[model samples]
Target: MDEIPIFIAILSFIVMCIGEILAYYSISLKYRYEFEAISFGFIFGVATLILIPKSFFEGFEIFVVFGMIVVYLIEKYLAYCPLSRKYCIECDNLEEVIKIKFIYPISFFIHTFIDGLIIAVSYISNIGLPLYFAILLHKLPAGFVLMSPLKGVYKNPLYPGVIVSFGTVLGTVIGLITLKNISPKILLAFSGGIFLGAFLMLVPHIYEHKKEKSFLYLLIGYILVMVITLIQ
Candidate 1:
């Protein structure tokens, strides 16, 4: 029983790795693939809406709301440090994509760290299977999305996958070591808020620079999220 969460965490990491590799190879490097990127945004937005609210209703109201407000503000208004600025330049050219590639690993590292922390906390607390699977499902798409931009910039193809997967592993290690000390519900709620804020911030940016100049990718993202929902 104690080891189950660890096992699942490792499995999710593997899934993420596989997703990244497959995406790196399958996606064309000749063009910027906006669809996969927006799909990632959609998955994150819908999951946040569902999971955070669920945590809120289940009695983590204060934590959930606090998390939501804090993350929303931080992501929306305060996410502009030197590093962030370097990462957020418009992805308009190959040079921009290369800059973004350097930025991608940093953002993905933080994101996956949270993923590992939550996965460890949830399973350690014996949280329900439904939520467990929900978390797992997100990692699958994350790999694809994390690799999308890099596909155009790097020739090795495996570099982005390894970088993002390393983030997951790093997060998992930290979570396994520290998560036992935190209240699972509180931790989960806070993470959910962060996820919501982060993804919410990306939605508009994705639409603004959409390759097709349409919401087709965003719609596809919604459909993908819906499919994950149905799987649940």
Candidate 2:
């Protein structure tokens, strides 16, 4: 079975923690739009430069679409669910409140879990370094996104960070256990789809709210990713 190196695992965990810490301290409602725009750009760049190319070369393009559809449906469900409420809101029913509160944190956990799986699988497949870099590059923005909604809701903001971190560890373990059966290409494609779907969902709202500034930031974010890719 393929295994992630101890150092790599540790480094990934540290980077994720750093992102969470930064978000906990720095993210605010005032700059939420800008943050979302940059996040969209980062995910776009990752999809374009890393995930799509890798998946296309391996003939797994269909899985990308499937992944996107999955996220779209999931987002729709979250949006329209009767039990759904904003993170900071209070619901009269305890069960419904718990369910509503957990929606985003659960999603964050799943996403980061896949991230861990991808990192482990990619490393085993010999494409670890760049993919790892790409994943690491986005961790900060991802942390912000994860924390933004849950920041004031949770008395200890560390809760969501711990959830995501646990997800990553579990994913790495699962990847190691299933290494022989899974294909990295398909995983990459699916992850790309999720990223694209998320970008599509988020960037539009940001564009509507911030117009030109959002566009400029989005472009800057994408360019930053490209520059990093070239450097790598």
Candidate 3:
């Protein structure tokens, strides 16, 4: 067989790609889900760093930026068909929501990059292969969870969304390169910055619609996922 880490590392991408399909199928399976799927993608970044060795942080940091682009593309597909100017019910008025209105169509791309790193880190972590496996198991759920938000933003099915998830390959390649030349302490500090950016961007979303039980739970899960990621 192939070298284990090398193999697992590469395999991670395949698992992620398959996950998107699995996620889409889940809706057909009829699970009650919120549109806030991108949130999981962000949390994945934080968790990836936490579980992996401190040394891998720099590699992880670079992977996140690239991965965000992947998420943006996915959102592009979801928003492309543009169904109703009316599905946006979360906000009190269109006037206030309009400022960030441009973001949803592509923001999901950012979310996936975070998710890619999260999956990558599990492979890198003290959680070991089993933890990695556990993470891969959630890939489908993640796909579906993420898809929910895009569905609401645009009634169109996610075509680019499928393409964007392919970024898992780019994410893995860059991360592997970082593995060869980065110092752990520096990486940790860098990771802190990345997570901070993602956290700041997402925290408000979680707080904005605090009324939804599912979203409230997602935030709790988000924080919990982050907490699990810190130095564990």
Candidate 4:
């Protein structure tokens, strides 16, 4: 059921975000906005893929982009698109559309397998608790923020959400395999990067919902992450 940890984990995220009063307040204030960086910093780290070919990294990078597309797909589901003429809003249209629009089962199986691998590795490594918390804290608002693009595409919301979830499985696989061998400094940096990206996704919501920003929630986010680290 995922009833136990799912809730606790979600609660932890709430607490963590609530706890950071300064950051929460900071987000609401004047100096609190960001523009999307239209670039990837090809960061040449210490101990890069000397043995691992450049092609492998290139392949994985392509896969990661593919996964993002899946995420975009799943995100469509989380948003309500009244203008969507794909299915009847009230009738059995949704079920019917879901049946026909769904791509090949075999394609999804391969996609899901990769996505599952990513989630499994990340969860097994215990970054999952924090990642889960991070995701829950941001998902609802993030969904709304994403509505802009989803509207542009004009598709059913549920379809994209499924795609995104499957993408996570793929990410978990790649993350797990490479993370272990990477330098400690790199791992720390990578984890921090993950947290940063999570926050980047959180920003638009924080801005849009400034009145609802909770300092305590931010504080709780920090404390809970620390606690999770201790447990791990």
**Ranking, TM-score, top scorer first:** 2, 1, 3, 4
TM-score of model 3 relative to the true fold?
Answer: 0.48
- TM-score, one value per model: 0.63, 0.70, 0.48, 0.39
Residue clash pairs of candidate 1: none
| Model 1 C-alpha lDDT per residue in residues 1-232, reported as the tens digit of each score | 6466667767877887877776767753222336435544554645464455455545676675676676555444333223322123334433345445565566666667666666676565555354456456656656766666666778875766676676655666677787788776677676666556555565665555564543676566556656656666
Model 4: CA > 4 A from native = 1-128, 140-152, 197-205, 227-232
lDDT of 2 by residue, 29-103 (tens): 456567657757877887888777877754577888887887777666643233332222222343353553577
Worst 10 residues of 2 by lDDT: 82-91
Please say which candidate is ahead in TM-score: 2 or 4.
2
lDDT of 4 by residue, 1-232 (tens): 2243334433432332332222323233222211111000100110021111211432344433443454344323432223221111222323333332342222333433332342333444443554444434433322222222333343554345344333433444455555566543333333333333323333333334332543334444455555555575
Listed per candidate, the RMSD to the true structure in angstroms reads 5.6, 4.9, 8.0, 12.9
Highest-scoring model, lDDT: 2
When 2 and 3 are scored with TM-score, the better candidate is 2
Check candidate 2 and list the clashing pairs. Answer: none
* Model 3 C-alpha lDDT per residue in residues 102-196, reported as the tens digit of each score: 44424444444444444444344334443344334444544554454454444443565565554554454555555435544443434444544
Q: What C-alpha lDDT, on a 0 to 100 scale, does residue 179 get in candidate 2?
A: 72
Clashing pairs in 3: 35-149, 37-145, 55-184, 71-108, 71-109, 72-109
List where candidate 2 sits over 4 angstroms from the true fold. 1-12, 15-36, 57-59, 79-96, 148-157, 228-232
